[model samples]
Target chain A: MKKIIFGIAFLIFFSFLIVSAINMRTFGEPAYSEMDDYFIENAQSETGANNVVTSVVFDYRGFDTLGEATVLFTAVVGVIALFRGVKK
Target chain B: MKEMSRIVKTVTNFVYGFIIIFGFYIIAHGHLTPGGGFQGGAVVGSAFALLLVSYGSLNSQKFLKKDILSLFEGFGLILFIVLGFSGLGITFFYNFLANSGGWFGNAAVIGVNPGNMNTGGVIPLMNIAVGLEVLSAFGVIVLTMASAAEFTKKKEKS
Candidate 1:
């Protein structure tokens, strides 16, 4: 019974993924790209980073990086706390 | 937990240095090249994991100090926040130093030419900061997990 349920769920999920993949647009050509065009054109001069991805990650969307760092910090804290009593 | 076999130790010893160096290169060249802080830091952290796995927790404890990792983790995060706050004269995380003809402040090279290191303003700094944070965080996590696994193994044995 469990196997049957899992098989049904897996088929449903797989079909959903396959449908999304088929409906997706062509490779290297996204449907909405105005932001991409702006970044490609202006990122270098605006942020002085030749790497637009870095500029986007660190400068244009810096808050996201901060949040990422915070998340990492929290994870470390949690891991260490969990293992503290196990220290030899 | 005991160390791995000699072959694993030998391979780890040979490859870890190069892995660390490559990670640093990725972080330092983040603004000019493809990878950034997170990618480079992950590479270095995997090197740490490799060392821990080969050497085990007891021997690895000497080199992989938890206090130092915590210190660096906190320091890197604080440095990032400070860097952002320093630019508050304009706004948070503002690129105030770009094209200003100072340290890491030069006009970016146009077109498809070789990029310079002394450009990109706070991007490189942020990259380094984030790289440091990520490396230490992953190190701490790996170390903690290894220690926990040792505990579980002992519990099972007893």
Candidate 2:
């Protein structure tokens, strides 16, 4: 019974994944990209970072990075709390 | 929780410093290169994990102090927020220093060119802040997990 249920679930999940993959847009040429053009043209002069990806991460979208840091901090806190047991 | 083989310890001693240096290089040159704070910090934290795995819980305990890791993590987060607010005259996370002819304020050429270190405004500062926080957080996580495993092992043995 368990095996049958798992097989059915797996088939359902795989079909959903395949449908999403088929629907994905073509690589590189995004459908809507006003922001991409602006960044490519002006990020270097504006942020003064030659690596545009770094400029986007650290400057244009810094709040996202900050949130990432907070996530890491929270994970550490939870791990330490869970593992505070003393060895016998 | 005991130390690994002699060969593993020997290799770890020889290789950990280089790993740490490479990670720091990635963090420092984040604006000029592909890597940034989180990526570089992960690299360094992996090195620490390598050392802990090789040297065992006892020797690792001497170096991996929970309090110190917590301190560094908190300091990094605070510094990042402070840097963000420093640009409050403009806006949060504003590149107020860019093109101002001060430190990290040089105007970059609009087209292709070699990268310069002193060119990313508050980006480098943010990178450093995020790097420290990540490095310490990773260290703390690994240390706690290992210690918990050791504790459970002892509990089972008893």
Whole-model Cα lDDT per candidate?
0.92, 0.88
Task: Show where candidate 2 strays beyond 4 Å.
Answer: A1-25, A85-88
Worst 10 residues of 2 chain A by lDDT: A79-88
In lDDT terms, how accurate is model 2? 0.88
TM-score of each: 0.88, 0.88
Question: To one decimal, what is the Cα RMSD in angstroms of model 1 from the true structure?
Answer: 3.3
TM accuracy, model 2? 0.88
What does candidate 2's lDDT look like per residue over A1-88, in tens digits?
9999999999999999999999999899899999999999999999999999998987888888878888888888788777665552
Residues B31-82, model 1: lDDT tens digits? 9999999999999999999999899998999999978998999999999999
Across all candidates, the chain A TM-score values are 0.72, 0.67
**Clashing residue pairs, candidate 2?**
none
Alpha-carbon RMSD, each predicted model: 3.3, 3.3
lDDT for position A80 in model 1:
79
Evaluate model 2 with DockQ and give the value.
0.63
